[model samples]
Target: MNSIRANPQAGLDIHMLDVQFIRDNLEAVKANCKNRNVTADVDRVVALDEQRRQILQQQQVHQHRQNEISKLIPKEKDKDKKQALIQEGRDLREKVAALENQVKEVEAELKTVLMTIPNMSHPDAPVGLTPADNKVISKVGEPKKFDFKPKDHVALAEALDIVDFEAGSSVAGQKFYFLKNEAVLLELALVQYAFGKLLEKGYTPIITPDVAKVDVLEGIGFMPRGPETQIYSLANTDLCLIATAEITLGGMHRDRIFDELDLPIKYVGMSHCFRTEAGAPGRDTRGLYRVHQFTKVEMFVFCTPDQSDGLHQELLAIEESIFQGLGLPYHVIDTCTGDLGGPAYRKFDIETWMPARGEAGEYGEVTSTSNCTDFQSRRLGIRFKSTKQKGTRFVHTLNGTAVAVSRALVAILENYQQADGSVVIPEALKRWVGRDVISRKGGISG
Candidate 1:
């Protein structure tokens, strides 16, 4: 890894630790951002931090004066002197209170500013502003050549009676849909298949909680219960519904330290994830491609820094294998620096070929995996010790999607449709779904 100074001009959110680290290795942070296309706002964040420290100094001076006056008032030699000391203490208390309020305000503003800064990108990340700029690293299984005009997932869903978009809209508004008949079964089959594979690969099975505390949510790098987020919050609770199993899984070990021997822990979790889809108002609102809520099997691992890179690739392989088993035409892309989220140092996404998307059938993202390194571990206080090391070090964390049931159903249903309006369930999932095919007669309507 190369080290470079972080550019103060680059738009990045830096904390106390980030500043200290950058100050010690400014060149490394800057070079990393340049390589990853990560924009860091070092100048602004650092200046505000400096302001915060200056405010603290003023506050400390006032507090010290108050403390000295407090001690003096009790032992004044004369009445006038004692009265003056008491008055001075009251005035000092007022000034200190006002300064404290200002400090709180500055701190809050600083937090908001810092939150906008993106994480440093990996050296290998492609540089671009949008998904269009994402570099395709690999393509697998040539896209199926179709002779007839292909129906989009929505049209095919209606024709096959496998999805209920209208009813879903009527009941839960747009972006909320119901998977009927084969679609439902396919969802179950996908989750089971993915979960079983994860188990075979030495991952512990867990069904995590769907709701998490606000602090836990923030600690895991998600905005806690906000309109700008894609997460839903309970009306009267401090908990917010998770956008993915990663939230709950990551929160599981919050404020805890792990034993040195347990340097690596892997978990496969199944959970009903909820998202408000706040920013994406109209995109992918037609069907299961984008929904307010969905079930997913998520893979999360905590390991020592030395093992993270290998584990990251392993997680990516598992995602690719699941897509391969489904027999869907897809491509893998290395996410760019500008597009990667706050927690991801590097990310890879699997986009399946969706016949309904574009003129020649565009790809739709099915799964993504991120190597967060120690960013999350530091915030969560999850550290592990090694026998050879003097003290514990923050562990690296990674998360990848094993199966997102709703979207997988979309991929399978659209890709497997027959000319006769029936669906052929993938052979790998037959035993789990208990049906080989879904034909029109079996899809009889009410």
Candidate 2:
């Protein structure tokens, strides 16, 4: 990796960091962004880059003249010549300082714009702006036919006395809820079941910190210290609540290099992730679909570039197996370029069929896997050394949602609803949940 060149590939537009590289391959960078569905202001990045370069050039010229004039002053014995050299050097210094100041301003502006630009889309990614544009590669199982009008999770939670949205809202504002009775047991069972399965698959189980430093958050591509985004920052510290376990796991190996043999270091991290939901104020506030804080089992992998592709697919398979074990109907969709996050090189989302969330029985995304090919590693300075390969190379990092317990609970409740307002648990999880269906075997009215 060239220190001066930020990845100036044909597909990547040059930013302040990659100005020199972008200057050499300007057309290629613009073309790549276009092909990747990255709607970057390529023209703006290019123009700012040129301005920064011109300012830098002007500063360099002034510094060179200043150096030459200083050397001449020592050789010139005449008073008038010495005075002239000193005056010339002073003028050069002033000009250089002004030009350097302009360069700094442009560089700062370039960073703000470049950081917001989305990563280039994978060539295979479909072209679309929203989830609606996502391509469904496979649809598994079928939506069950209901004999009666099924109550939504919110209604069922109230009717069955399994959740307390009112008390939660009263205490902690809306979108917060307490899982009561069977819902509590069900949540515990789900977390343990998912943890056991990942342990069986040789993943190192760890319950990570729910909060991290702002620098760590930024290293993982999250703007933790910003006010415009959805981060929950601490009052006086440089810390912020982590939006996902991925943030903690991503920071675990920061500024450290790994052995090549440890190439696919898999982690099964459980944490209570927090989000402010800044951009989404009213959306999904009805139930457990969206919330301020929720427990999650996240899967993160650190692998070499050659190993990332297969590892990404493997992570997706693990997510699918978990859903399949739950006996829920789901579809795997290839997320389009526009829908991918800033660090994701490619992404795949598994949307489960939910009958109550939206009109006409919609699907809700339960889990997603992303291949962030060396993007986060580069930012975090994580690398691996291979004996066969010459030097250390940045490892490709990937993250997958194993089970967001809340949303999975939402899907299971809504999709497996019985006519009597009870939810049937998947047969495979009966041993863990200790019940086949969530119902008051006695009565709803205590």
Candidate 3:
């Protein structure tokens, strides 16, 4: 029932938005909900908060009367008078207990209603209903014009004996595949390449747990249990398999209060991500483009409010650098309000050109960076104390995909495919992959 309180020590009563803020900005909050395509009753939250306050006042009054009766009972000399005072005290105690219970019930209801409300969107974010409405920021590097028919990742992977879909399906059900031969090497190289880039940016590298507690997931704005949830929960346990390293990284500092000097704490996390791909039936179902599980390198940052905007752009720039290093052609997108996740105030995505996507070629999202702007930190109870400020304040949180190995491979393979059925590895990853190209005859050779 304590859905929002992940940090017991923090004593944080506020979730995404406190009742007072909702009351003051009632119209704005309601409009944000509409813009984000979220349905929430803003008025109900205010009503529940008022009801809870009233019950608490009544409970305090009865508690005070009970205390007074107890004192009188101890001093009274007459036996009947003493007994009557004790009885009165007992009656008052019952009334106080009943009111206390009502307060708790109302508080639970209030939190439940608040959970339905999402974080406010950034003012600069475009207001739209779908991906079509998202604004294009910039396009980088031109898509390659192939002299011959280029194969999609599936055909390229299968023809070169780099991935075994049948075995993967037989072993782990559908939407799973085995990386064979050089594909295994490619995944490792991609991770190493991303890690190297992040390390250069002074990011601490961490290998995070693939599974996290349900509350931790919720604290990071993920629904771990529901019909629409893309998360996979372990039966008979409160843990769920993580969909991204962002969940574990964000939960890492739960209930923590850092010094202002440590305002920007950056981490590059590596983890195996799992998703059910719920409601995504047939769209991009083929190959590694849309899969149930994959390896990922994720970037997470926690910083003061003033530092978050710059850090968000920095994350996006890192993502762009990684893709650009791989020689992949891509474009940047400013995500619209409706396309943004519940915790993201603003988001930007890098869509890499995949050679065999449509009839000719198309852009597909490979990485994204989001500025949550204290939305997640509030839920996770992560705060920072400044030398100038009196008390601690919730730190802003941001996450970006450094590299999703599966999708990165899809882009690399399709884009670098040659007429002779060979796929060239990017120069940046050549050292780690230990080869210049992957072909049937050479397996992996220069």
Candidate 4:
């Protein structure tokens, strides 16, 4: 629980909430913690803040006394009197310095505790703790009905020689694989398709760095260092492998101010995301369904507070459009309070139906969009001001997965598999992947 960072500038992004906000809304913040099932000690922030303030006051008093003594020493003619005054001034300076250090310790402790608290949930979000409690907003496309005994992505990949997990494990480790032949082409197609769609929607595309500073990861609500972190850390360094494009893209605008006319800046970032997959040992780990590394196209937005909800929906719509373009069946769910983790005021998840998830087919989460509502912007110090506005306000931030190349491949391979063992490509990927089918043999050759 003691996560006080040792870095001198540790609190920059992680401590964006005003201490005054915690002081004034103690009960509400506590209520939010209860709703989200988080264990943040709200009372601790208040108590430590009081101590910080007291230390500040003591330092100020000591400073004033030192100033007075220095002034009086200049006029005193007696050598003993002047010397004593100078000693007193030196002692006061030491006392002030000690108090200042105490203030820093108290403030740092306070910030660590405050950042543990989750953002306030949207009032419209349903109250629940599990998947069953999530509200089904709508089902996008109807589930596929197959005449053939459809095989999962694993079997299809084996048949077509599109993935090499055994070779991957020998080289890297488990949950790592080489996307061979058609799969590699499919990965690129998904990236290009998602990027093309997002670009058409006025989103600026960027290829983000795969690694980020630990603080930038923390600012975007990811734990870069911890017992239960999904992040991969470098030895004796502040850098960690990013889990998504969200981290680098969000960090790009850190400590930046924007004009209101430039409000709602949309970015589509592509990156090779890495995660430890630390505790993810479950049924979902069959194939590309869960992995340590994957290519992803992520959507990030920075808009005014009033624009967040609408932009969130727009992000969702784009996700649906991409899936629909690929002719995949999926459903949208309004994520519940307990499931909505830190930084998201509200969240929507898109689950695409995979024909071989279980005995029968099941839905697996493919993409998710969240209305972060200044939670990340505050942490990163991103603000916007309008000509009609007085002061700059934190711009709301949102992020959505345009395409997770691996999972999209799973959906594509299983759904488009032919009885003859060849896999028909989705129309969306036809252009990039060239000919329509991935043949039963090695490569996608004529």
| Distance from true location, Cα of 366 in model 3, Å | 0.4
Worst 10 residues of 2 by lDDT: 8-17
Q: Which runs in model 4 stand beyond 4 Å of their true positions? A: 1-16, 64-85, 388-390
Give me the overall lDDT of model 4. 0.87
Runs in model 3 lying further than 4 Å from the true structure: 1-14, 63-89, 444-446
What is the RMSD of candidate 2? 5.2
Predictions in order: lDDT? 0.79, 0.80, 0.90, 0.87
Highest lDDT scorer: 3
Per residue, candidate 1 scores C-alpha lDDT tens digits across 173-288 of 87778888877878888988999899999999999988988766776789864558877878889888888999889878865667768868999999998888889878876778
Top candidate by TM-score = 3
Those runs of model 2 whose alpha carbons end farther than 4 Å from true positions after fitting are: 1-25, 31-39, 43-106, 225-228, 441-446
Give the candidates in order of TM-score, highest first. Answer: 3, 4, 1, 2
Q: What global local distance difference test value does model 2 have?
A: 0.80
lDDT for model 1: 0.79
lDDT string, candidate 2, 64-154, tens digits: 7888998899899999989988998888888877776776677667877766555545778887766678899998899877888867788
Error of 3 at 55 (Å): 1.4
- For model 2, state the Cα shift of residue 375 in Å: 1.7
